[model samples]
Structures are given as structure tokens and as C-alpha cells.
Target: MLKYYNELLYFAQKLVGDKEKAKDIIQETYSKVLETQNKREIKNQRAYLYKVAKNVAVDEAIQNQKLQTAVYEESEHLTQKHEQPEEIAIKQNQEELFMQIVNKLPKRAREAFILYTIDEYSRKEIGKIMDITSNAVEKLIKRATLKIEEELAKKGF
Candidate 1:
């Protein structure tokens, strides 16, 4: 174990992306290996140690990912109204410009684009809502996007 200390540390560090966490994983792996009841039946001690290290590292990574996801969700829940004034202003400007371009679209194209983009409607759902076929929804959305792109280009956007 002493011979493989640095090597195991390097392996765990590579797997976990953190030195302190890797060290803890290696220590736990060593403890688990030392407590094994069938030590004599092991064919290769070094290989067994590496396998244990990998398992511990994988478990640690999974736990860390769950913890990070939970923390992110909690923070998002706690900060529902945390938008900065500058960000709000920029978003409003972009939304206003998008609405201006969208209003200039042909009536059917405008409806399709709004349903698809702003309302987050699927093409089939837009078809149901717009009383048109799904293929027509696709074509209208595509034409609206192209017209918006051309308008933005004309405005040096």
C-alpha cells in the first residue's frame, strides 16, 4: 500500500477532479481493503486495491453530482426574483425587438412562430391550435425565421 500511495492518489485525483476528495477516497479504499475477511484468497493485491479505489471514486462522484444538483435546485427556488436591473433591461429590449419583427410577419407565419417559439408548442400542437397541418406549421415557422433573420441583417444586428 505504501508503494502504491502516490500512484493511487494520482488515479483517484484524475477520477474525482479534486485532491482532498481523492485523498479521502483512497483512505476509505484502504480501510475497506484492510477489513476484507478473505485477504488470502485475493489473486493480485494491487489489482484489487485499484478496483476498490475506482468503485469508491465512482460512488463519491455520484454523490457529489446529486449534492450539486440539489443545491442548484434549492438556490433557484430561493431566488425566484433575483434578476439584475441590467439583465432585465437587456431581456426586455431583445423581447421588444423580437415582437416588432414577429408582428411584421405574414399573419399565418406570425401565429405559427409565436405558438412554436414563445408558447413552446410542438409542430403538431401548433397545427391543432392554428387549424393547419403539421407540414404547414413547419413551413410557416421556417419562413418566419428566415424573414426575421433577413430583417436583423438589414438592421446590422
Candidate 2:
């Protein structure tokens, strides 16, 4: 159980994408799993623990999202240092172009792709993090992959 804690922490971090939030979520998950185990008819302990942890993670994410405020103040401050609106406009244009390309990807495929390609995660590692099979990760990456020729053709990556 203690050994699995490290893996659990890893999954929570990847799922939450924030170290501090992941720590809180994992701690809550451990407490809940222990308390539930003590009071319940023990069935599949491992699955039960995973299910409990997953639920806690989901709840935490939803709760955090509801309170989130998307702010561009920091970006605006940086733009002041850029000395010109052209620089700011260029930055905005680049961001828009990148997102346009990303939006073309399938949902799970894009998630797996960004995690694996952009973040340099392994298929096995991403599988555990995304709660999917390794083969599924591979397929998602393959499906989302753009050939160099195709990217060049569309002027997108």
C-alpha cells in the first residue's frame, strides 16, 4: 500500500497538472480509502481505492475550476515591456495559430499527444495517468500525429 503511494501521487499530479493540488488530492484520497476500508465489506480493495481516489480527484478539479479566473494581466504587463503593439499582436497571432492546430486534433488524441509529445511522457506512464491502457495511448498518439508533409501543406503543426 505504501509503495503504491508513489504511483498514486504520480497519477494525481498528472491528472491535476498542479503539484500542490495533487498533494492535497492524494492526501484526501488516502484518508478516505483508509476510512472506507475500515467500515466496508471488502471487495476488490485495489479497484475500490482507485475508484475512490479518482472521484476525489475529479471533485477537486471541478471545485478548483469553478473558482478559477482567467486573467491576462500578467501578459499585459509583459506586453508593456515589449515596446510596441506589433510584438503583442504577433504573440497573440502565434497563440491563436497554435490553438487552431490543436483544435483540429481529436479530444483524447490531443490530450495524449500534448502529454506525450510536448511534456515528454512515456506511453506506459501516460496510460496510468490518463486511466487508459498503454495501447490506447499509442493509438491516440498515432491518430493525432501529423506527418511533416501534411503539416507543411497546411502551414500548421
Candidate 3:
């Protein structure tokens, strides 16, 4: 429990790209995991923790987007307190650029990259999550990396 704190925090931070948000995510993940009797029922405890963390982080991201848009509709710039205008602008710019790169990837390849690279999911677990072979996951990751590299090189990265 205490041992995996840093790992879980790191995973959530990668998923959301925010430290405070990541802390919330980790706390929620712990709460959810404790709610299920399966906590003591699973042999693969670390994998279970990671899976729950991924699900919670992803859900929070999606929910946050909707909430932000609603704030915009109200003619309010700040979705959450402490998010300054310049910071928001920079974040939006980065997100747009990142999505542009991601758009170049095939659907499955992008998903594989998100799971493996961003969420740090194991190859075997990602295969199980995506319902594909681990070999296929490897191939998809390779292709996705190449495509991203090519795109970045075009921009002189």
C-alpha cells in the first residue's frame, strides 16, 4: 500500500499532466479499490491497482473536458481556481499540438501508445485490455512510434 504510492502518483500524473489532479486521482483510485472485496481476492495486486488508477484518471480527464466547456459557455475563463490565463493558453496550445500528432497515428496504434507509453500498462495487460495479442501490441507500438517520429522530424524535432 505505502510502497506503491509513488508509482501510482507517477501513473496518475502522466495520465492527467497535473500534480494536484494526480493526487486526487490516486486517492480516488485507492478509495475505489478498497470498496471492492476483490482487493484481497486478486493475486496480481499491482496490476489491479494500476488498472483501477488508469480507469479513474481517464474518467476524470473526460469529465473535466465537459466541465471546462460548460465554464466557457458561461463566459467564464477559469474552469478551476488557480488556473491562470497564460497557463491555460499554453496548456491549450500544447494539447492542440499533441492531438495533431496523435491524429496521424492509426486508431489502434494510438490506443496502444496511450496504454503502454502514457499509462505505463504492461504489454500483456494492454493486450488483454485491447483484446489483442502481445505481439500485435508490440507491432502497433513500433508503428505508432515511427509515425510520431516522422511527424516530429517534419517539424525539426
lDDT of 2: 0.68
TM-score of 3: 0.41
Best candidate, lDDT = 1
**How much is 106 displaced in model 1, in angstroms?**
1.0
Instruction: Kindly provide the TM-score of model 1 when superposed on the true structure, using C-alpha atoms.
Output: 0.43
Candidate 2 deviant stretches above 4 angstroms:
66-157
Question: Of the candidates numbered 1 and 2, which has the greater lDDT value?
Answer: 1
Ranking by lDDT: 1, 3, 2
TM per candidate comes to 0.43, 0.39, 0.41
Q: Per-residue lDDT tens digits of candidate 1, residues 86-143? A: 2343456566777799999999999999989998999999999889999999999999
| Cα misplacement distance, residue 37 of candidate 3 (Å) | 63
Model 3 error, position 72 (Å)? 42
Candidate 1 vs candidate 3: which has greater TM-score?
A: 1
How big is the positional error of residue 46 in model 2, measured in Å on the Cα after superposition?
A: 2.7
- Candidates in descending TM-score order: 1, 3, 2
- The candidate scoring highest on TM-score is 1
Q: Name the lDDT value of residue 31 in candidate 3.
A: 84
